[model samples]
Target chain A: MIKKLRIMIGTNKKNILALTFIFSSLLVLASTQFPPWDVPVEANDLENPITVDKKNLDAGKAFFDLSCKACHGATGLGDGAVPSGDFTTKAFTGQTDGAIFWKIQQGRGLMPSFKAVQETSLWQAITYIRTLAAPQEIVAMKNATIVIEFDESNSKKLITAKVYETLENGEQAPAKEVKVNFFIKRYFADMLIGGSNNYTDDNGSVSISFPEGVPGKEGKLQVMAKLDDSGFNPAGLTEEVAWGVEKAAYWNDDRQLWKNNDFVPLWLLISFFGVIGGILIAILYVLLQVVKIRKLGVGR
Target chain B: MSAETTDIQKTGRSLKEITSDLLNPIRSKKSSVSLWTMLLVFIIIIGVYAYIYQTMTGLGVTAMRDYTSWGMYIGHFVFLVAVSLVGSLVTAILKLLEIKWAAPITRIAEIIAVAAVALAAITIVLDMGRPDRVLNIFLHGRIQSPIVWDVTVVNMYLLISVILLYLPMIPDIAIMRDTLTDRPKWQRKMYKVLALNWRGTDEQWRLLKRSIRIMLIVIMPVAFAIHTVTSWLFAVNSRAGWDSTIFGPYFVAGAFMVGAAAVIAAMYIFWATKPAYKKYITSKHFDMMGRLLVLTGLVYLYFNVNEYLVPGFKMQKLDGQHLMDLFVGHEAPLFWATQIGGLILPVFLLCFKKFRKPLPIFIISIFVIFFAWTKRLLIVIPTLLTPTFPIQNVPESWHHYIPTYYEIAITSMTVALVLLIITWFTKYFPIIPIWEMAKENGHDNPHEKVVLDDIEKD
Candidate 1:
């Protein structure tokens, strides 16, 4: 059986050992340093007293902003402006609600104890903390489909788009009065192709016409309609059509430090090399003198 | 009066008496290892074991984390480099300025410098999480990085210190080669090899003096560079408490203060242990060093005030929290103690002539060294903890750094290792320059006199 296991794992002993070493290292890294902190048996066994409903969530959020936002950040992502204990870890979230309440009541190190806060309020805060799982942007967008359609009946080159809300039965109905943007896509970013006063009408549709000679490949035009709303993922739909003259790619010679182009200022280049090069050369010269002196000794 | 004539008219110890007196430490039977040495060795063993444990377990064994990345190790490194600069200050700078009284103290400074710089190098490596990747620094070093500058200056400082330690010891080594012919075969061979076959020819002496002069001139800037670049490792960062123009001079001033204190501490230890060299290291030397310490202390005090006061007064938004922590918050106790006890109190003590005596000076130096070490800890840790924005997702323990037992052990090991280096060096070497003392006392080497005259004429 041992021989069969060896054959299944690796033929060579060294290879098997290397694989074991790598796998064990990964296991160690995956494990958190936070061992289970001691909690009172009462606290450990107790369930959160407050019901987790919308009212409790709002209450929890109010308290969280009041007490914890400075350190725990708005979303409880441990990115507070003030230095404090990170509550975003599995080690933190894995604890029972009572244990968290106890910890908050009796703070350690940089974390302040919230003993004055009522137990029900603390429970509400814990509920808010729990709600901070990754935001539901993608899921919300998937449930709302946006469609763009083009009509050029009068050769006016008009484009129309619509937003539809998906029902529980997987059926779609028109969504009304939602703002939409029509834009032509560019290399660095999308260029808005329509006016700012654009939105879906009561019928859930937007109509706009193409502007002059926006160039693309082989006189092809690419335009998109996007649903722009705060706290929601932007749902976009794009359409391609042969409409305008083709334009060759052009270069922008703007100088920026992050772009890695060799457009550094002359004085900066001179000063950097002059100072660092001078110091290095001076140090090197001194070292070389030591070598010369060592050579002057009785024996080489 | 010419130097040679004045030496003849001075407190005349004959050449033979000087030679025998200076060489007694080296030629005598090796002193049995003291209990202190044994204790140091034991601590070093434990430290090595702890290091092995740390390497196996990773840096998690230490209390350091993303926020407070550096801990006691970097603090200890700063202390080592600070003390090591005394070698340049005493030996090279004083010798170049032609200070006659500094001769007996020069070797002590050089040995301390050698040991401390060596330890500084080792301690910095110990600070690295993956020390094996240290070679990658040289292989893929960015010239613009402050770390590269630190490495460059530190290595240069080490090389210069070692050479400076060796150059003046050549004549003394020759004395050992000739005098200790009756010693063990291995020791005799070792002395012979290290002595560089000095026949005491006039030409050789001239060349030696010229080399020593060149090294002295070159080493001053290198010494200053080593510590300045080290300070820049923090100062170059935009972090509060570190983002000041005064750090370079501030660090240099503080280094000289602690360096002088270290030399005083060593002087007391050596003077108390070995009575044979009582004539060589006298109370007069202690008085001079005490006065020098007071000057450095005052300068360091001025810089310390400038370092803190300007920021505290302006209360710039970035530095406000850090200054508050240092001034009145959790860090205030250590901060105030370091300033008052380490910098201000030493100056106060050294100001009185009565305290400039050897024993009082030694005790004061102990306080200085201790406080200086803690001061470095304050410099490295509090600023790191008070960074403007907090690093996310780390355990709260990352907010405040308290070095673990492993860190304490490794730091203690480096300290003990430096002492061990000094111990072995004192055991094997003369610790005082026999020929130089003899020459200074007007036991004229006729050959050297001719060479000196010729060089002066040319």
Candidate 2:
């Protein structure tokens, strides 16, 4: 009888488990459909009015920081003024400049209408928006490539910059005597650090060194190598190295507890331990009294 | 002034007869296995299963996200700690004051305290995402954090409360060991070991009295410290509802109120279940508990006024949103109902002589206990929702905290576990102090009942 009951229970359990699996798979399939995002046909064909020049990009960045940064985020990573949605998807950059312009002009849901900003300014914003894609991706270069390496293991800050020229058959050859400018990245702009301009060696590498114990925010020194816009499109890359594992010295007066200050007050320590100690002693005394009573019986 | 004389007036029974009647509970203390007991066991089993599921699954089984980091579990933690303070109030404060009416209720109060505090510890563990990392609190604890202080005081309070509960029960355990001859052998042996050779000698009585007195004196501050430190956990964070200089005393006063109400509820339950316990836990005991509840309630009411109304009168920008939320927003109805129906109506009703009757007091105390728990939720949830900085870059779902099915099941299990612990304790031991009642009736040497009963027959 028990064997028959066990078989029945086991089969029922199998059926239940199978049903649960099917139900969960159905839920997974149902959630894959994306919501419709309507776009105008004219937006795809409209040409960008603003040129991708240095001056226009800078103005666009300034305007983006003022207005669009609140919603679209600083790097347009979708972590912005909005509470929902991943705005940093590839779809953000996949759209044409005109499509992005139309989206900006026509606000949907939480997005506000940006028609208030003029056409040239909007186009410039779009130019800046193109740079919002992953900064680590090397822009395709016909002539040269810039690579930066930051090494901070030793007692000195070392930044190695190398430039390579691409031949017609797609082979990389070292480009000697190329001037590389190394800068430490700051809040708004990069500060020229150590040798601002140094020519690469025969190996196509330029190494710049700075003194140890230099202070930086959050214990990081961002080293940037720039090949200025002289012949080919100016190429630059940045790499961060550890400085000191402490906040910048200028922020020493900050009230942050983790930054090497006495986090706890002395009085709090005394009061807490004092209470604990008193309780411990009292409990000890009580237990000892119980033991004493048990060991020696009371007299008549 | 004679204890014997008072017993004669109260029950018209001599010391010997009274002691025999009192010992009846210990002799007859078998597991009755009622429907209620069975139901509690079933629920407890389900609760344990839920907790295991929660542990295997992450705390994500609950709907708690970044914004609503704390939910019902924390509220229950604070509530349990608050309710546990009744042990200190009844056992220590009343003992020191020598209130004779409070004598019968201390064991019940202590049991509630032990059960609530033990469960309060578990409730906190439930709130942790990684409960195994709990040892890290001790390994690398920063004395700076209120969390460290909370842990220190809560542990201390638990130790002191347990010792206080045990110290008084030793003589009673000895009484059970000697008198309950027909009880199960294991039970008798358990009592024998727990009794620690208590002989009712003068030295033993002196030591027990001295130790109890010392523990009673020591436990009060530790009890105060536990709840005060609990309050600081929130108050130190600078949250709107919690960031007040008055939170420590406010919480302590509110704790006493809830603790008293919890004791009254337990007294009523015990009074209802044990048909033989009517003489010991009389309506007079309920009357005294009612007055005590009212007294504590008035103090809690005063703190509640200071907590809400003063800032509420001229609401500051930071305090405004929190106050409005409690006053007229989503939480307004529950908040107002808890305050008026739970707090004010009970206080007003308790002032009347008719309401102080056992059944009426029990009903009101039920309201008080219910409100006491919801009151902690009000304090925790509203302040969290109205954070000083605007919430950005999160889903709208993160804005509201709704406890999931698993969280609710686990919380309910903690309550059931507390009841189960209390149930198990009441099954073996006498709920009232057998030896203390004998001594109060001038049967100072409790061993005489075992020795003299056979002597009288011979």
Candidate 3:
């Protein structure tokens, strides 16, 4: 009977563990679940009026970055702080331009509606989102190179990029009118240095005076020049330069009141312990006197 | 020798008579006292039940939410801490200044101090959502935090107050051990054990006096530190109502005011109820305590003007909002009532010789003590309600705070606990120090000199 009771208790323990596991899993799942959202049928059939071009995509990308990127993520992977629609997914991309537009215009639950946004800007945002669905082919220049140089002849620091393409006869020729973009690499993302008007001249180079007050490690910055036009293979050159403002040392080991117990300010430690210790000794002395009084009573 | 003999004749009662008079309340079993004890016990039981329910459920049982996080419990804590300062004021400060009249009232103040500080410590735990994690405070205490400082000084204050209470009571306890032969065997044993086997030796008296003297001096700063640290718990935060440079002295001043009032209230209750106590706690004591109250109240009034008027003159945006709420807004009634009725009128009325009488001053003290509590709540709640940023996205109930019934019940339990402790101390032992009264009546050694044969006959 005792063995039977032991077996029943063992089974009960297992049952309780299993129940706890199931309950915890349900709680986790319930917390992560998003409420369902629906769009009107008429809204789903509307077409996007804006064409997908470099200029329009650029405008849309700027707007998306300012607003939607915090929720929808940089590459639209729905992996932002707030869970949002992944534009790369068929679940999102298969929806008509009108459905996506309607969702953006009329938000649900945690999602905020963009009713105050301009109509043209909304279409431009849609045009840029379509490019996130899949990768596209790029035609490459067989032998091409880009060089970044710091030109200080004009008193101000200028970052100049020269683009070159090798001809059939193996001669390097200036690749004129080739759109180039210059950027300074930062921790999270590259910051554009030269504006969108950057294009190679007949000398195969474009120049932009370096901006001031950009913080860098030890005053050195990583400058990159990339080919921006669509018909070329992905290419860019990165060079470490000394154009950025020097970053001061951010952290120090000085003692502070806010520091942990090990590193409390020296003066505070002394005063705190000194006052408390003095009082404690006084208290101990009084307690000892009481003990003496008790002993004196015993002797008497 | 002539002066001492004349002083003894002034009381017109022998040392033996004084001892028995003081010890009579302990021997008498009054039905009214039993009923009062029962009522306090009933309230304590209900409070304990509510506390258990709160711990079982959570702090959610209280009306406190995210915005008004430190609600009624914290207000009670501040009030208790403030009231506990009475011990140092009556026993240490007055004794050090050689004020002879305050000697009879010291034990009453010490009892209030011990009870208030003990409840103040418990009230902090009651405010915690997780009372079980209270040990984490000592395990990982940061010295720089105002909270750790508060806990340290409060514990120190409690220890010192208890010692002050106990050291003076040893001779009296010895008196009970020897003279109260008809008490229960357990009661006799308790008195004997707690008496430290005193035979009233000169050396024992010497040590007792020395220890009490040391405690009297040490308790003053520890008492000051306790309330000052409690004030820092608010002043360290950059809240509108609490941000002040003079908060330390301001709190100390306010503490003395309320502490004096609390002592006066206790004095009146004892004087009115126990006929034997009237000779010791006389209208003279009431008149003296009333004057002390008025003095503290005026000092507090000075700090009050500095606290409010300077800020009111500037009327900085946040400070203005906070001041406006107190001056002419929703909280104006409580604010004005606490200031005018509690502080101003009590101070104003107590200044007069007629109003300084026992019955009148006691009534005023009741108002003062009650309004002092409301003043603490006003200091805590309104500032919390007026946040630096607008309070948004919470439930409508979060906007205003009215303590739930459970909170009120739990708070009332602390009050009952204080009263119950005082009642037990008075019932089981003499509240007034017999030896001190005899000494005051010019007996150098009251315990040895006074004949106890008649005490047994009585």
Candidate 4:
């Protein structure tokens, strides 16, 4: 009697493998194609960044000083008392004066569309934003000799570069390409030596072989690395950056900065199916219960 | 086999013939320290205790985890319910078709129907995680759930089944009241109350017949609903083996199949006990039951193929592990055993004339019932073991569930409790419907009346 169920229940190994492949592919597709956490970022202002009126420029400058100046600085070199890095994005640099004026007239993304700000004020901010760049005299480092080494037995790639500085304390670090910005709180205020620039090698690793820049004597130098986002000062670092050629300083590979969320992607699909399952069980249970209770009450 | 010829042959064979001449029943209840009945009863008591413990502790006592929320209780409930459907085959199907061979066993079949359905109800309640919150169901009833459908149909089936068993017993109750001289006065009163002043009038008989007919017709759909809803509980879920479109019919066929097998097992037990019962039941009864088993098996087999083949062809990702688990993975042994031992072999064995004979048919029915039940267990447990995640977290014990000692005790208790109900009912009431039998045999046999009266007398 029991043997009746034993027949032909297994699929061939190859079939199982094929099933596994198909299932995995579907899992990948489901996770990637319909990601749940891609939060929307607005960037509409750049499409039309120009504003024409002189009155609008003044108004734009007022609005800019209220919001943008703290980040881009009074001179837009990002060197205010609290100074920040420049936010002269590609749209700002590439735009015509008219476009820049319009951008000040209307902000985009994190920049609230200040279309409400006077059109003149919007144009003024745009004109200022168009002039975004790093200040000139980078800091020179304290006079010091440094050693460096390259080890390739384990790793196959490395980046090599050097930097020098020309200024101290109030001089500030000159910004490089200004591609990215990171903000730091004011806890480490006593550590500033001040400005310089460093460069990057083709291999993505940075090694300062003859690294020299900033505070060039026995004092301090502020050197900038090619890894800088753009030429903006006051890039919101709390601690004063040390000026020295530390031996063989390099960055490990930046494998990836983001991870694809697994559970959330599958959540919607699972929930959809789960609800369906719940509905089915619910129906069966309710239908039966209603009849049972009714029968029990009615006694017929 | 024309009914005319069958009736003539039946007439030639005296209705008063004693079948107990060659065999005797192993007394169901032991007189001493432990009876076979008590063992089943003890297990049942422990099981009941376990149930009480569960009700207090909540469904946490069972090995059910998040993945396999519905566990052995529901499986047990489903098996018992399937067994309950056997009554329809005996009382409704065979009776309506005028299969005179069913005479001796109809009463027994009815008892099985009542007992199994009753137990099924208890077990389903046990299956609920929040039995306390069960009232919330009525308070907040939803038509969408399969559980509600099941509760509805099962209640209807139970009501109709109990009434079916009772209505046919009126004339016999009267016989117990007045004609049984050896019976004490109190017993007579009890019988009189049950008889409800029945005088065997033509109107009463007509009403009885009409009601039985109505019940039989009504019961068919209700029976389908109980099992079909059970299937939907699985099928509508987007789980692997459960998501099949064919589950409704599959479950129904399986229910009737297992049900027929249960009837066969009960028939054998009745025959073995030989409890002054053979005069009422004949060898032809066994043959008819065997035939019924075969028919159900074939229908179940058809559904099984539809269930397996469609999923196998599609090979969807959701169904992958579920199919593998049943067919080739961990559940394989039980799966195959249920198919072959529970369903196929009994069907094949009972297919033959000799195997369909009383004793062999009866023996095979037990195997079929055991296998059928295990099949239900496999259906539920394996799906849970393979829930989408690589099952992790919590105690490692959460990953697996072999029912605890107390769990088995409670399960056995349910089975024994059901058996006890059937036993008491049969011991007090003559299992053969006297009024129906007398009517069928034309009530003119002085000798047949004498022999039947001898048993009815006490």
The TM-score obtained by chain A of candidate 2 when compared with the true chain A: 0.40
Isolated chain B TM-score per model: 0.94, 0.94, 0.95, 0.87
- What residue runs in model 4 are displaced by over 4 Å at the alpha carbon? A1-300, B1-34, B181-186, B444-458
Cα lDDT of model 3 by residue, B1-458, tens digit: 23444456676666667777898888775536578888998777767766765776577667787689999999999999999999999999998898999888999999999999999999999998789999988889988888998888898899889999999999889888888888889999999899887877778878888888999999998999999989999999999999989999999999999999999999999999888888888889999999999999999999999999999999999999999999999999999999999999999999899999999999999999999999999989999998999985444677788897678878999999999999998988788888778777766534443423333444
TM-scores, in order shown? 0.66, 0.72, 0.68, 0.56
Kindly list the per-residue Cα lDDT of model 2 for residues A160-247, writing each as its tens digit: 8889978779999987776677777777866777653487899989888865555776677777787742223467888777754455
DockQ score of the complex predicted as candidate 3? 0.21
Model 2 misplacement above 4 A: A1-156, A161-264, A297-300, B1-26, B29-33, B445-458
Please report, as a residue range, the 10-residue window in candidate 3 chain B with the lowest summed lDDT: B448-457
Q: Is the docking of candidate 1 incorrect, acceptable, medium or high quality?
A: incorrect
TM-score of chain A of each: 0.39, 0.40, 0.60, 0.23
Higher-scoring candidate on DockQ, 1 or 2: 2
lDDT of 2 at B311: 86
Cα lDDT tens digits for candidate 4, B1-458: 23433453466432232212211121133335337666766556556555665565556455676666767777888899888988887788887888777766787788899999988987877777567777766565444455765776777678778877876776566556555545556767888667655544444444545655666666666677778878887777677677678888877778787877777777677666664566556678777778878988899888888888888888777577778878897778888988888877887888789998887887788888898899888877777777666764333555566665445656777889888887667656766666556555554343223324433333
Residue-wise lDDT of candidate 2 within B1-458, one digit each (tens)? 34534444464445445546666655665557878778887666656655665675567567677778899999999999999999999999999999877888899999999999999988889898889999988888877777878887887888888898899988777766766778888888898788888776667778888999999999988888899999999988888888899999999999999999999999999898777678788999988899999999999999999999988988998788889989998899999989987789999999998999989999999999999999999989878888789876454567777776667778888898888888788778778876567556555544433323422343
Per-residue lDDT of B182-254 in model 1, one digit per residue for the tens? Answer: 8889988988777666655656676667767777877788899889989999998899889988899999999
Candidate 3 vs. true structure, TM-score: 0.68
Best by lDDT: 3
**Per-prediction fnat:** 0.05, 0.40, 0.53, 0.00
